[model samples]
Target: MPKVRVHNMTISLDGFSAGENQRIDAPFGDGVGWGDELHAWFVEASRDAAAGKTGTDVDYYVRGDENIGATIMGRNMFGPQRGPWQDESWKGWWGENPPYHHDVFVLTHHPRPKLEMDGGTTFHFTDDTPERVLERAFEAADGKDVRIGGGAAVVQQYLRAGLIDELHLVIAPLLIGRGERLLDNVAEGVEGYRVAEMVSSSSVTHVMLVRR
Candidate 1:
């Protein structure tokens, strides 16, 4: 079975995922607004895990399972764009090499040619619904788990559709106050979730959830 998971999603104390006026220049809000703390967490986690140190479990959680064979993300998560996308020049912020060196499927209303970057990473834009994306991702996953990279709304769509099996959220100490909240209208229909694990670090609190 292919498990759908959201790893290292950063949220604020006020429930905002990102600060207001999310732009290309300020992907995770201005300054060190919301995602700064989370970004640091990623760096540290990567370092420790790669070094075989047991500090934060995030690095282990994200890379522990090499079984994660495929990824599906929203358009916004791929790039910063509102309404319809007019051009395909925006190859994402990760530059020539993206972190995901595997197959990645992007969910979008508008379709664009598949993009292959350095490493084994390939971004395929899909106009189909979340189900279709998941299907394709599962095929690509090769019986491994499929990760759902989000920009909030996309996660909600899959969650409400009861497609997500696990969610790993990293709560930062800061507060956005008025940006896009991750759980805005999402939990309304969700029966509930259970905390599989929780870890407290100096910068953020990592919580793992499994659907009940």
Candidate 2:
């Protein structure tokens, strides 16, 4: 059975997944600015992966992209542009080639046409619930796993619905005073899940949770 997993999601010490006032200029919000500090480790790992380097932490971070046939993310994760597709020219934050080389199902209130980009990445906008989207993603996956590539709110919805089978969170050292927290309003959400592994590097702590 294919698992629904959330991998390499970086969060602040204060539990905020993203800083406040997210806009086109600042994607990760006003304070964080695309999560430079929070996502620095994974960025470095990705660079190392691109450079053909392999280590325990780097492999762990980079391996999330493997065997992931489809991904589900919120509109915020896709870009800062909100409301009814102001301009069709805005493809995404990533230029021609996005990191995701598979199908990406974006949760949005407004409908948009399917966008096909370079590197085999295609974005599909939907207004369906998490379960419905997961069903679609699973069908698209074709036996590969479904990844929840989130911007916090989408992950929270899946977490609350008990849909996630594995979660790998990278806790950064810094703190965002105010923003959207990942674990907010979902008390005991990990009741059946337990910490399967915990590894710490200089900048971040990786915690992997698996359902029992």
Candidate 3:
């Protein structure tokens, strides 16, 4: 059985995933966001690219995972800015190409045409509910896992629905104080998960959790 996994997500000591007023210039928030802890993780994740390698952590995480067939992300995670779709010119923040090579489903209130970028990445916007989007993504994945590449809200939906199988988080050592918190106002009686493993690198502390 393929697992629905969430990985490489960063959180503040206070549980804020990202700071408020996030923009193209300041995606993660202003100031020493997450401090040195997050900088190290970012450096390592992009180390291969920094070393001039063709692959990145994104590739390594998805590659060879026979159970991984598709990805689901929020509209915000797909690009910058918020609110209704003003135009279609905003291709994405990633240069001419993006890292996602597989089929990706995006959750959005507004509908937009699918975007096909270089390197085999395609974004499909869905007006359907989260469960419907998950179903579609899983079907497209062909029995493989579906990664929830989130911008907090999307992850929260899945978490609330108990549709997630694994939770992988990287705890950064900084505090946003304000901004969107990952589990803010979480509904009560939510399922409890057990920490399965943990790894601390010079950059970040990676924690893995499995539904208990």
Give the candidate number with the greatest TM-score: 2
Best by lDDT: 2
Off by over 4 Å in 3: 32-39, 48-67
Q: List the residue pairs that clash in candidate 2.
A: none
TM-score of each: 0.90, 0.95, 0.84
Q: For candidate 1, what is the lDDT?
A: 0.80
Predicted structure 2: lDDT: 0.88
lDDT of 1 at 121: 87
- lDDT of candidate 1 over 1-212, digit per residue (tens): 67998887878777777777778777776554332564667777777676777766556355534678899988888988866777678888789899788889998888889999998889998889899889999998889999988878888988888888988888878766777888877775367678888888777888888988
Worst 10-residue lDDT window for candidate 1 reads: 30-39
Q: Give lDDT for model 3.
A: 0.74
lDDT of 2 by residue, 146-171 (tens): 99999899988888888999999888
Clashes of 3: 3
Distance from true location, Cα of 124 in model 1, Å = 0.7
Quick one: RMSD of model 2? 1.3
Q: Candidate 1, residue 190: CA error in Å? A: 3.0
Worst 10 residues of 2 by lDDT: 26-35
Question: Model 2 clash tally?
Answer: 0
